[model samples]
Target chain A: MVERALLLCLLLIGFWGVVAKKNIIKKIFGLNILNAAAVMLFILEGNRIGSEAPILESGLAQVVDPIPQALMLTAIVIGVCVTALALALAVHLYQITGSFDIETIRERIQDET
Target chain B: MGKRKAWSPTLQACLAIGAMGVVLLPVFLSQTPWPTVARDYLMQYGQDESGARNLVSAIYLGYRAFDTLGETIVLLVAVIGTMGLLSRVESLVNTVGDDDNTIQTVSAFSLRGDKRSSHVLRTHLLEVVTGKIGPIVLLFGFYVMLYGHLSPGGGFQGGVIIASGIVFLALGNQQDNTSALSKSSILGGIESVSFLLFIIVAMSGIFFGKGFFGNPLADSAYPVGFIVLLNSIIGLKVGASIGFMCIAMMGGHD
Candidate 1:
């Protein structure tokens, strides 16, 4: 129960970081944090009361849901691609305008327009 | 000033409603027993399709190979689009020629200036492991792709695992090997090979009177293994394509 609450709290913190971070690079890092928190929450949620192995065997004990674990693997891959792309975009944007700050970039774009 | 005054009341109302929606969503979600529903569904229909003990892998690769294909396309498209956007063929090469620019800048220098670093990792253990274990993992990922039909893994997972191995080189040997490693022609070769292989697999159904992307080889003797084989092919394509894409983007970026 306490673990569940802590997971939720960390998820919220991750969300806050994505929303509140000023630097575009930091925002990408925040997004990665948020993704990690979501994956952790999923794994935590799928835990059985006393499941033994994710690999289903015949007669030992209850097994946890391997679905979320498998899905989370997909999610992790997609997350990596997303983070890489975001960071790439950030790097390119910085190269263009010479600023990592989101507000500064927005202002520069506005000036250009 | 007029726009600010005009938007204030509407914005306040939207914020209040949005906050309420966020608060109420979890409350509504908690009342349902979704996991039990999923489990019961899996127990009924998941086993035969997925040969492995892990039912999740079965659903992902077996029951939902179509969706996985679509997901692979998304990653592929992202890599291609990034390459189109960032391939600074002329200026990037010129930038790489500078000797003074190679120093690692730990502080905020001029924003317009690009810094190149030839800093090697000080850790001896990392050098040994990355040199040895990295290529082995990449080769193993291909094995995972080939054997996904009989085992607990598939193409997407194996492909990403292989990409992770490639990332080690990028981090370890973070020099201007981008152009040398990520040649556009090489990426084209990898992409076309996978795309052609996928089309051939799908078209085999037409030639052999099986359904689209159907296993012509599967019969009562060992019907399911062919689908797993298809999964592996898809996995190999996706994994190699992504690995090459990441290297290409990293290499091309100035």
Candidate 2:
């Protein structure tokens, strides 16, 4: 329960970073943080049922749920892909506007028109 | 100023945080117990069914293989999008470099020195270390990828490691004998070829009447062979795509 509380705080922190940060790079960091929190939360929840890792060996006790771990694998991969795409977009924006700040970029774009 | 800053940024942050908390409170507070049905069933027959000692591997590479296919497709698309945007940025930079006044020109830097210790670019010592360690990391990545059925690591983990190795190789390209794997064209070719091979293997299961992504070797003594093959294919695809993206991001324009 305490762990879940901590993860919620982490989620909120990441959300705040995304919402409040003016820099596009910082926003990408926030997204990665948010993704990390969600992944950790899912793995934690899935771990509630057992004490062992999902790898099977002879005479081993009950293992934790592999389903959530498996699902989280996909989530983590997608998160990486999303982060790469986001960073690429950020770089492109920087090249275009010569600024990392979202507000500055927007203002510059507006001026270009 | 249009509105004289009517609402403070802090107030807006507070509102967003409060709304987010309201939305997520239920999820964090939920007391519903984790179900055990699937876990129990997987424990009982996962090894026998998939020939994988690792149940996680069994689930992803066995039951939910189509999902893995989709994940790979997503990775491919992300790489494609990144490379596309990157090429545009490259061309933009090149056009800017047409003017002699632009100090950011690639040619301008190369003419400065044989060992370019640019503001944030590589150092000689770092290059040497990364170049030495890169191939070993790649070897370990293949090891983990091949033995994933019985171990903790899998295609995704090993593939990420392999990407790091490729990044290392690219970073250490000041030396001879390092240009081959770091070449964007070769990396792109590897990614495309592996994706094709993945589809071919996936379709091979159909000819064996094992349905889509079904283990064609299920009846054989090496049912886990299918998992191993899939892991390698996935590892190659992931590593190549990510490596290509990283190389491009590092301004390996070719």
Candidate 3:
């Protein structure tokens, strides 16, 4: 219950960052935090009553779900790729508009159009 | 402007937070963790079927090899997209002319700046430290990739580590004469070749009467060798692709 609450709090914080922040980079970071929270939630959900590391060693009765761990690995990689792509886009936008502020960029686009 | 002013930042934040809370409330309240059936199956037959001691490796390389392939393709697309974005700046700089002053100003504007002309920016300590530790880091990445089947670390982790070592080297030494374009192309070629080899291996499983990505060498003496091979291929592809992305994103301003 505590873990779930912590994860939800993290999600809320990330949501606030994304919604309240004006800087595009900060929004990207907020998105990353959300991704991390979701990954942790999945890993936490996979914990069993008597779980050990999912290695094939002798004398191990229970093992945590390897499926969630593997899936989370994929999620983490995808998050990284998405972050890189987003940063690239941000850099390109910054180059063209000379600002990181979303509102200013939008205003400039409107003026140009 | 009037419409935008109606919703202040604090109000927007509160609304978002409240909405998220409401959406997540039920999920958090009724969280009954269920037992996974696949866990039992994987733990029981993972070693014999996949020949990998590490259960995660068994699942990643054997049971869900297709997903790994898809992930590598996603990485490849990201590398390509980053290169596309950064190379435009490089071309813009080149077309602007041969004037050194203009080139310096343009590169500075483009975020790569002139590294060769600015000698004072070079720090001797960083150069020495990276030179000493870079090879060890690369070796460790190799160790992780090679021993992935038996250990916790795998291709993605090892590849990122190797890419970081390359980044450290790139940052520490500015006097290297190799053009960024050539280096990027070489890395791109390696990425493509490794991905192709991965696909070929997947196809070879079909040729051997096994299903696609099915373990053809499961009955062989060294059953785990195929997983090792797949891990190495993925590691090389990921490392090269990431290295290419970093160098490309740094732009060819050097």
Candidate 4:
């Protein structure tokens, strides 16, 4: 329960960073934090039913659910893809506006028109 | 007045996040039990069916292989998008010889040390250390990738490590960044070829009457051969694409 609360706090912290942070890079950082919180939550849930890792060794039962772990691997890869794309977008924005600040980029775009 | 204006947005953001948290509270606090039937079933037959000791590997590379293919496609799309976006953004990183006053920007792939003979910041130690360690890391990545069926690591994990190894190789070359692995063209080729091979292997199962992503070697003495092949292919594809992107980002042209 305490772990869940801590993960919730982490999720909120990531949300705050995404919503309140001005720098696009920091926003990406927050997005990763959010991704981490999610992956951790899934893993934690899977841990509830197992005393061993998902590897099948001799005389080992009660192994954690491998489904969540496999699913989370896909999620982690997708997260990486999203992050790389976001960072590239940020770079393009920086190249255009010459600033990482969201307000400044908005102002630059508005001025451009 | 200005201070209050700055503080108000923070407060608003907090309230918004708090609202989201409240809405998500039931989800986080839910006491429902996770289903164990799948785990139990997989534990009993996953090894025999997939020939993988690691059940997680068995799931991704065997039972849910179609999802792996989809994820790789997503990764490829991301790489393509990044390449298109970063082509124009290269000017941002290729800032060589604009300022001669304080610090000179050298490309990470630059082979000419004589061009940068002024006030070096002790880069020799870093170069020597990472240069010696890069190939070792690549070897370890391959080891992890190949042994994933029997171990904790898998294609994605090993691939990320391999990409890091490539980055280290790119960074370590003080005289010449001629490592074939660091070249974007080579990396791109490897990625493309591996993806093609992955599809070919997937379709090969169709000819064997096992359907897509089914193990064609199910009747062979070593059924695990298919999983190992898939793991290696995925690892190479991921490592190459990521290394390609990282090299491009590091301003390593050609």
**Index of the highest-lDDT prediction:** 4
**Worst 10 contiguous positions by lDDT, candidate 4 chain B:** B102-111
Per-residue lDDT tens digits of candidate 2, residues A5-108?
99999999999999999999899999999999999988988888998999998887778999999999999999999999998898889788888898899899
For each candidate in turn, give its C-alpha RMSD to the true structure in angstroms: 5.8, 3.2, 4.1, 3.0
TM-score (C-alpha) between model 4 and the true structure: 0.93
Ranking of all predicted structures according to TM-score, beginning with the best and ending with the worst: 4, 2, 3, 1
Clashing pairs in 3: none
Question: First chain TM-score in every candidate?
Answer: 0.90, 0.97, 0.95, 0.98
Q: After superposition, how far is residue B62 of candidate 4 from its true place, in Å?
A: 0.7
lDDT tens readout by residue for model 4, B141-251: 999999999999989989998998998898787666478888788999999999999999999999999999989999888889999999999999999988888877766
lDDT of each: 0.60, 0.86, 0.78, 0.87
TM-score of 2: 0.92
Per-candidate TM vs. native? 0.74, 0.92, 0.89, 0.93
Candidates 2 and 4: which is better by TM-score?
Answer: 4
B36-112 in candidate 2: lDDT tens per residue?
Answer: 99999999999999999989999999999989999999999999999888788764444453443445533222222
* Error of model 4, residue B200, in angstroms: 0.2
What digit string (tens of lDDT, one per residue) describes model 4 on residues A18-102? 9999999999999999999999999999988997999998899699999999999999999999999998898889878888999
Off by over 4 Å in 4: B1-7, B93-112, B115-122
The docking category that best describes candidate 4 is: high
- Candidate ordering by lDDT (highest first): 4, 2, 3, 1
